[model samples]
Target: MDKRFIEEQDVIFNAKPDAVPYNYRISYKVAQVCLILAKSCWGKSGCLPIKLHMISFALCSKEAMDKLLIFTQSEYAEVPIVRFDPAVNSAVTFGIADGLIFQGQNGKYALTDKGRFFVSKIEKESTVLSAEKKDLSLLSTKLTDAKIKQLSDIWRNIYAED
Candidate 1:
């Protein structure tokens, strides 16, 4: 976690699109992993708070979508960060229904054997996926439910302003 995020009332979710081509085999956006884990009749992503925050963070992160440039300032340096987007959550549900993501006991989402095989194949075949796997791994290691909730609050504040 960045110190600034903890110290400041405002937090930035720098959602820039990665250069990776879609992993056509998986055919889903990134944020749905949380849903894949949570909606399962099994175990959830640790708990409701963890599930929401983790998925929400993915939806707002650079790994999920590329940012578009808008010149709100004379220096052409303004960038928009998203707070929360429902579409991602819906997509996650769809992923679960479609069998791309599965939930076992406790609601923790595990990639189906298919998903695992697809990832393995993608890692071997796609440079972009390889990089994303790295990014996802790093992000996964660094979050807790509390931290995610903090970030989610910041996102909601921005969302409410609109």
Candidate 2:
């Protein structure tokens, strides 16, 4: 994995709840993309360009891209990813500007100060509680009960259909 990409994921994994919902959502998705790109780029010469980044990230689901465009439009009023090129595969051709993610000409996305603070707080909390350690015991019990009830309802429905 690319060192920078791993660092970026660490930053995201630690993201705080107080962040603007839109920004947080975008940052998280982008960070995930970076991790995948970085893994693919390991020991390779050239880094994957923005177009490839979009393709790599959007491959699993356009849901990520759709949410990103919505966030960018609402937050920065920018529509960088609007263009679609036919020459490349439809999946890979969608391009967005770097400015929407990175502030300067670093050619890579870095979190803003607010983004950093939010991530730091979240990371700290995550370390303290850990997902498994956190108390969701009650919720888990309720969820199991709900699932059982739903299955029972489905069984009744199947018999009624006959």
Candidate 3:
């Protein structure tokens, strides 16, 4: 159509994209994982299966919680399907690379000393992640690996049958 308009469109297409938002940044996600581990781990071990981490992270979202609450009260009586966010793996990898966390042979992730210190800082702030901290605290150790796996199996079975 118009030559100048085509050139302008090309420039727009080549422009650099905006930076990832603070909530999606790896450092911020690492902090979120560490806080989750600190609050939700069953014992002093401060370790959790990766799948459970996904669940806990999903629970941090108000939307996810609302859907879960409604699902629990519904008559279908089926296992709730959780949406797994793949971005969490990057945060976990960054934590391991930075020595903030470690993955065990048992496939569980536990915070290192440095990670604990980082989480302590986040905790002391009281303003950052306040809502997530409160939600995770209320859900401490309630979402176990076994329970997650059971739900996953049910989901797979239902989908597989269809």
Candidate 4:
């Protein structure tokens, strides 16, 4: 019922109709990163310096961090969620979690003004798209009860196979 669902549905339909389910996962993951960045920006000069170990602990895996970083970067490279490698002297980019640790002395990672701006953009777009989907669902009302049940059964079976 959330607005993000609408946007996610729209994204699925337009960008990758064949992978509707994946849209849900992608939206949830992006939202999670937004929340994490928001929380980290709560104090200080809107910056939070977090260690890679802490991020790994929080997310439960380095792979998750990697995926999240990739997703964030792909979606918003200009206002990226994380910095690249900080531990080494070289300039290697890592996930946001890893970047937090490497940021300059006060290098803690915080959402840039632009990053905060995008949070609302993402949320709003998601909500609008989801709302439109709900509107489309109304078309199903014309279906017979039996047809609805059959479709439901088919979906259930398809999902159960996994």
Candidate 5:
């Protein structure tokens, strides 16, 4: 092995644990999933398929929020572009493990009573996820399950393009 390779390995091995990026942190993703469930799913019966969760999380970005707003205002005249995020699976799993989220018989995810209480705490803070809170509240229950299904089909078509 080259001397440089050994030095790089030493550096990596000796490095201390760094802080995880906010997006990748389990707690952050869990909170995001819970907030999405509370705002988007609760009104419709407190559950949404994993696809909806992925799409909803994708919309959390400021750019995606703009797209979502346009879609909502235009009455879905055109399908807005949305991308699937696999990272949401990890978050959902963590939520399930912690008893903050549950899967229904239909394989949809919903907030548990514990999850609702956690969300209440998040809501009362008025600081955590403040921008996301505003955005999600504006979108509460607007993207129905049927609409989400349509959106997924549209997304599939978009990705299928050569």
Candidate 6:
């Protein structure tokens, strides 16, 4: 109705079909890292929490019935709920539960030896963890190839497997 509103609508209309804010890419990156770490440390000893179960179940449902979809008409649905939290939280929370990391004396979260073994592909120049290593390398390269070397050690330590 107003001049400012009209201009804003015009910009939205002309934007690319899949356009998203920069933060979306960054958050998506973080989500991927979390999933990778979780899969690396996967165990069948326990069940996933309700939120995770719902998201997983919904994601596999009929497209129109999928609550996890970006767009949904259900009254209980949130326009964009349940992404960064489950991925990131499960990574850290399960890491602790699985003895993959611990709180150091200095209050820093440090990876346990078991955790370090999982991400060891980034260091020690080994090819044993080929799949994981390749995935991590590609992801880091996408983020910034120059800095991946600098970050490799830290990534290996933080994302080691069970």
Q: Who wins the TM-score comparison?
A: 5
Q: Indicate whether candidate 1 or candidate 5 has the larger TM-score.
A: 5
TM-score of each: 0.43, 0.25, 0.72, 0.29, 0.75, 0.27
TM-score ranking from best candidate downward: 5, 3, 1, 4, 6, 2
Q: Choose 2 or 6, whichever is better by lDDT.
A: 6
Which residue pairs collide, candidate 5?
A: none
- Location of the lowest summed lDDT over 10 successive residues in candidate 5: 3-12
lDDT of 1 by residue, 1-162 (tens): 221111122212233366543322123353234322323212223334244434444434564423211211123333334444454456456555655556557664555654444344444444433444544444443334444455457568866776
TM-score-better candidate, 1 vs 2: 1
Q: For model 5, what is the alpha-carbon lDDT of residue 117?
A: 76
- The local distance difference test score of each candidate is 0.41, 0.34, 0.63, 0.36, 0.68, 0.36
CA lDDT of 16 in candidate 2? 55
lDDT of 3 by residue, 95-120 (tens): 78877788877667888877777777
Q: What is the C-alpha RMSD of each candidate to the true structure, in Å?
A: 14.9, 18.0, 11.4, 19.9, 10.2, 21.7
Identify the runs in model 1 with alpha carbons over 4 angstroms from their true place.
1-82, 104-108, 149-162
| Model 4: number of backbone collisions | 14
Error (Å) of candidate 1 at residue 137 is: 3.3
Error of 4 at 25 (Å): 10
lDDT (Cα, tens digit) per residue for candidate 4, span 41-159: 34334333332222312243344444434433343322212332233122113223333222335655445454455445554565633432232233212222333244345557866
lDDT of 2 by residue, 1-162 (tens): 222212433443345567464322444444333332232222223233443343333333345445433432353332323222232222111112322122235343334434334334444555532332222211122212233334345557866765
